[model samples]
Target: MKHSSAKEVEVRVKRTFLARKKPTNSLIDGQVKISIRFHQLKVRFKQLSVELNLFNNQSSDDRHIRCQRIGTRLHIFILIGSSIILALYSSLTQEIHHETILNPSETQYTTLAQVLGDCVVCPCSTFSVSHETFISIKPIYHHICSGDFVSSAWINFLLRSQFIDFVLYSDYHQQQQQQQQQQQQQQQQQQQQPQQQQQRQQQQQQKPPPPQQQRQQQPQQQRQQKPRQQQQQRRRQQQRQQKPPPQQQQPQQHQQQKQHQQQQVTTTTTTAQSVASAFWSFDNNALELYNSGLDATLSGSPIYTTSFAGYGAAISFTRSSTQYVYITPKVLPFNSRSFTIEAWIYPVSLSSSNDYGIFGQCQATSSNLCLYFIARNNKLLCGFYNNDIQGGTIITMSTWHHVACIYDLTTMTQQVWLDGSLDGSHSASAYNGLWGNTAIGATFQLGSASTFNGYIDNVRFEARAKNSTEILNDATLHVYYSFDGGSLTDNGPNGINATAYGSLSTTTGRVNQALQFSSGPYISYSYTPFYFLGISGSSFTIALWAKPTGSYAQQTILLVEQPSSWCVHYLVMTSTGQLVANCWIGSNIATNGPILSLNTWTHIAYTYSTTNGIRLYINGNQYSTTGSFTFSGSGVPMRFVLGGDRVVRQYM
Candidate 1:
């Protein structure tokens, strides 16, 4: 039989072989069957070869075919070789032609499913191919079947898409990690907060109890226990009251109670006593001046006596002669220890040699007495003349000034305060000396035996046996006046009928009354309208409270005119509410200080010295200037003026 197709040949070979194998088959038949089967096989093989040859002939120059045939020996080998060669050729051709798909399994297939996971079926496994599987199968597909170029293209697209998904996933995972960390930190903080709060509460609870709580507990216990003691005291008192029936004992008890009451009253009165009275002025009436006697002498201006001028007395002497003035009391008191000697004097001349103007002395002999006055070179000398240990320098121009000498025995120290400051001091073993007759002789004159000339007024001697602090605390020299023919009345020395000028009244405190002046002219014949509470030529402070009624043309409060050329004036209200001070030496107002306020009550103070010029203090503020003035020949023998001039009106 002639087989036309390869398919027919294959079929004929199979049928002939099966027919020969039946039961009752002849040798010839079998042989024929075998020959036919062999022929059919040969034919089928020839046809296959022809088809392959034709396929090869179509692309003769193709190296892929040559390679595929060269290695095709066994059937499995031909199968694998042909498949691999075809796949390789397909891949090469697709790549050359720029085809999208070359292989189905591999063929460099890139599909969304394969690159990520194989959603389509994977022929080799029960599960679908995952991204990892796809990656593994990729090289296999390149070496095996060649089909579905689209799968390869899709794989590449899926790989690009997978890269984008991977980036997003990574970002999301990082954000999740950060958020978790933050939450964990917050949780840790929350866990610690309760512990901190508990610690604070424990500290607050452990604080110490308040003072009020402790006090309250103690007081409550005391209050509960006090009632029983009170009840016992009441019972005792009742028993005593029922048994008190002795008349004589009652009288004695009554007298004792009265005496106890008196003692209590006395104690109360003493406790209530004031210290203000301790500073009261001394009794000036107790003092006496001995001017003409064996113990003392009198000289020029003998009219200036303590009897005549209340507290001031003066004695003058010339260069050729000597004079003295002394006081002797009827009773020589022994307790005259702490004393203050204040005097106002003008030195007419200063001696080159040491001069003595004895103020007070208890002298049985000349060398054994205590004395005080200006020494030679114008220094103040004070202490026992026999052995003078304590003294001070008084370097002032020859002029009139007020000087006060205070001696305190309790402290055993002598303090000489100039103006208000301590200028000098001395220490002594004892202040008490032998009591002798107090006297002033020719050697103890005012412008003493050495011819130092001047006038003196307002000499006050106070015996204060107490310490200085005690004496200052107890007594004050309240008032001082030089009665130069003026009535001793409550109204001041400037008379009531006087014009614009006013006067000091005695009705006020015992001290010297302040005189005020208005803006009109008031004249008087007697220049010494009010006695001048004079001062000696030394360091001194002049202070007074003054109020001006109106502005004045010329208002003079105090003036000093010397015999030769020295003059000083304290003028107030020369201008409205203004104070003027002028110091003249040798007929020239060498220094004219600035004026201060006068409208209101003002305390005006002037501290003057020959070495320090003049310092003015208004209400405690100091005033300074450049000009200097000095008394040249002798000190001024001038009287103080309240509202007018000393000698005459318009004396300036």
Candidate 2:
């Protein structure tokens, strides 16, 4: 009997897979029948391999040895002996696994079943987090002969359709929902602890546990059980002193449990204590500088990050050594009167000589302006300066607390709000207008004060005295410029027209088309009403994208000048290619900036908040300080101009 050639086998496989796929009973029906067919297939595969090898002019013994190796390569374990070759085919149970990608809709599940052909797909299990059912798709190699083109084609189709995008949308949504629910439950649990503690305290107060009686009874009981207790203690000591003494593992585990329980108790107390703070109480419109809350948005500008919420499970990062978050100054509303800073914290330890800081934007320079938290006297002391406005509130270690510090410049008072209630408040001279007016060039830092072993989240800084509900309300954006329009028209509601000056140079913008300058063309804006750009306010942020083809040295980007009064170069690449942000307030130059590279399109922002001095940022990162100088803003209304000092013939 003559067996088929490799070409004939290939052709048969192709025809069977392509044409007979939908035909019922194409494969053998019963298990007994299929087993017989599989054995016949194995014998045929050996015959074809041997014939193919011999056709290639290999010796008979060499072909036999090579065929055995080939069978192993083909994933078929075949033991070749002298009399016969025992070809072991993979059984159905061994080859097919009950696994799944996801429990898709009924229609999709049915579609997958139809598409997989002989490759069986079946539901197996579900994830605990999402409770999403998964389906397993066995690799097609188990069903097809090795080196078969039919299997290769089917594999490609499965790869593209089944797993390329690999998104189980419903499963992901369910996971998020589950996570949020769990977080809510945890918050609720944290809040209830304080109440439980209070109840326990009340019960103790009512009973007034007879200390004298208990002490007397304890001595009597100890006398009665002294021998037995001493014997047990002696046995334990003996065990410890034995040769190759084993350390009791149970003590370590018990210690850990005790630590965990202490943490839970601390968190509960913190949450319970904060039930009545001004923040998380009212809803209104206030400038929210930074917020990690999903329900809240930042006030003025949109922050872009590839790691949207990589900090923790969401936007909060789990505190660890070598981990800290430095928020860009552009996103902060640092210096303000009647402002509130709020954050959720989980501290690890509190018994250090040095104070542990939670959130701070402090200038170490002479201005001495900062807003931050420090662990002092084993309590959370929110201070503006040198524990100036400290609300002496007890802050235990290993706990989560919703902490807020509010300063009202008018009242010249500082209030520390913990968990939702008023922890304490102190009236300090630093809460006056002068303290609020100080510039803070300090970095907006979370977990940056020291080796802060804690997790912080929902760090919202409101520019006004905001109750909790008011903090919830989103801030309205006043003006926004896309520079997308062909014309120099403001994209915001207020039409701030910008006309090109002498030597109007136009080049492709950083994003699209930008106002260019080869011959140093400048832009002159139409003066709006005073206070249009805030008549006199240090709490302002100026950001722009600049691509310097040539040198912007000595030339200007935007100058807020009252002629000889305050010729402030808002944003300028210096003569040395360094970005210089300075206001020449009547020759008392207050410039604090960093060196910038030329030719590269850099997003530079200069923010001047009284609390956080003039902060310079390049591409979303705070560069090193260029040293400090006092900045006194002139109350005079300054004209905003681009390019040179004048709107014409003024640039290099």
Candidate 3:
């Protein structure tokens, strides 16, 4: 039993040992796995240490050295990229700064430094410039630049005492007046004679037929009478049949007729006096319109007719009639060494045998000693006593022509101008007054020498000779507007001004600068002082250049309104793009002209007269009238509205 017990114990111990040994083997496997993991971790740490050596120490192994080289290359690439990016950013900043400094207003640019051989770079401020700085200019011009010829005194002397003579009356007009008065007086005498005869007859009948004759008649009446009543009735019937009946007129009608005749006479006389006085312009001293001359008297039978310019009247003379304008000699200083004579003439007929005179001043004794402007051989001839300067251009008949003769004593030159051009020029000797004095106080008259037949107008005489520019200006210029001065200023003889309203800008134009209209812009001008534009005047011309942006129902380009009438005249653009000129008299009178294209410049002109009606021109060519119209308005134009009307707002 003891031996068995011992054996069992040993077995148990072996079993226990075996179990412990099995567990120890499993633990050893786990230890090996942990060692392998630790080994792998150590290798990774070594690799990290190698990467750190790029900034620290060198490597020896070839593979380690290759790894180091790759790492070093990546580091160098990153440094190069960062440097390039920084350089690019700095360059971009500099360029942006440079561009910002350069773009701004002229006054805002200020120079800090500059090189003599290169353009100076400037910096600009963002502030706005003042309006005065933009408009004002400081000129570096000297006063000496303006020569003495432009002096006020010199200009005044050149244009002083200018005169425009209108020959409007003659003896025929006066004789007609006198004949009308005589006829009126004769009619009055005839009317009074009949009335006086009727009054005498009535008095004779009312005086009881004289008492002696009445008594004898009564005895005869009693012898023939059947009864008193029957005898009276027979006598009354015989008296009515024997006496002549008197012509009768109602008393109220006669008084009214007499009053009407008196009113007619007063009206005629007042009109005649007013017309005569209108031609006479006087100063404070009652001096003539021309400071250098006096009033002239009409002679013969010159009549007033339509003028060459078609605006006013001219003097017409017949070939056989002794019609002329007589000026008191010595009133005009024709004795001046330098003088200019100019006139517009229309010759009707020229005589081959005689010279027709436009103006003549002859000596009291000798007709040869004359300073006469005459038409000889169908050409202008200016005579200074013995010397005569003849024009080259032939004088055409019927048509209007401008003739001027100038005597410049300073240059000893004589010039003849036709139609504002120099027709002839000649050297002349100075004239010595005849009989040791001026040949004044003699026969001095226009159209007096020999015979003159035709029309004459705007006869002018200047103490100084005019230049070619002046002559051309007189012939061609009326009013001119150049909108380049930033304002609507007139560069013409008449210094008219215009006012602008609303959004009116300027742009490139057919001329230097053109007016641009937007947001209901317009220009206005008064017509008070313009006589040619008077509403009572029958002739007028309007010209304008326009560029339309769009068409509208009714766009008023020009509007002439009166205080009495709302719109006396208007030039409008219709929805159909046609230009229409309308005038209101008792009714509407309108003329439709050419169509206006959008966004294009066009020139338009309209002329009106009672005789010619309405004439519209487009771009220098006459357009076919779409409608014919006439104007008989008598209201005075108050103002001219351009680009719009008083109510309707039209943009252009």
- Worst lDDT 10-window in candidate 1: 272-281
Q: List ranges where model 1 is wrong by over 4 Å.
A: 1-313, 317-329, 334-336, 341-387, 392-407, 414-424, 431-434, 441-460, 465-525, 528-652
lDDT score for residue 444 of model 1: 37
Residue-level lDDT tens digits of model 3 in 355-375: 777765543222234577778
Error of 2 at 29 (Å): 99
Per-candidate TM-scores read: 0.33, 0.26, 0.36
- Which tens-of-lDDT digit does each residue in 123-185 have in candidate 1? 223222332232111111221223564576766654332211110012233456668879999
For each predicted model, how many residue pairs clash, with residues at least 3 apart or on different chains? 39, 36, 0
lDDT values, one for every candidate? 0.44, 0.50, 0.60
How well does model 3 score by local distance difference test?
A: 0.60
The TM-score, computed over Cα atoms with residue i paired to residue i, of candidate 2 is: 0.26
On lDDT, who's better, 2 or 3? 3
Candidate 2, superposed: residue stretches over 4 Å from native: 1-478, 503-505, 528-537, 563-565, 584-586, 590-594, 626-630, 644-652
Task: Provide the RMSD of all predictions against the true structure, rounded to 1 decimal.
Answer: 51.6, 32.3, 42.6
State the displacement of the C-alpha of residue 610, model 2, in Å, after optimal TM-score superposition: 1.8
Q: Arrange candidates, best TM-score first.
A: 3, 1, 2
Q: What C-alpha lDDT, on a 0 to 100 scale, does residue 564 get in candidate 1?
A: 42
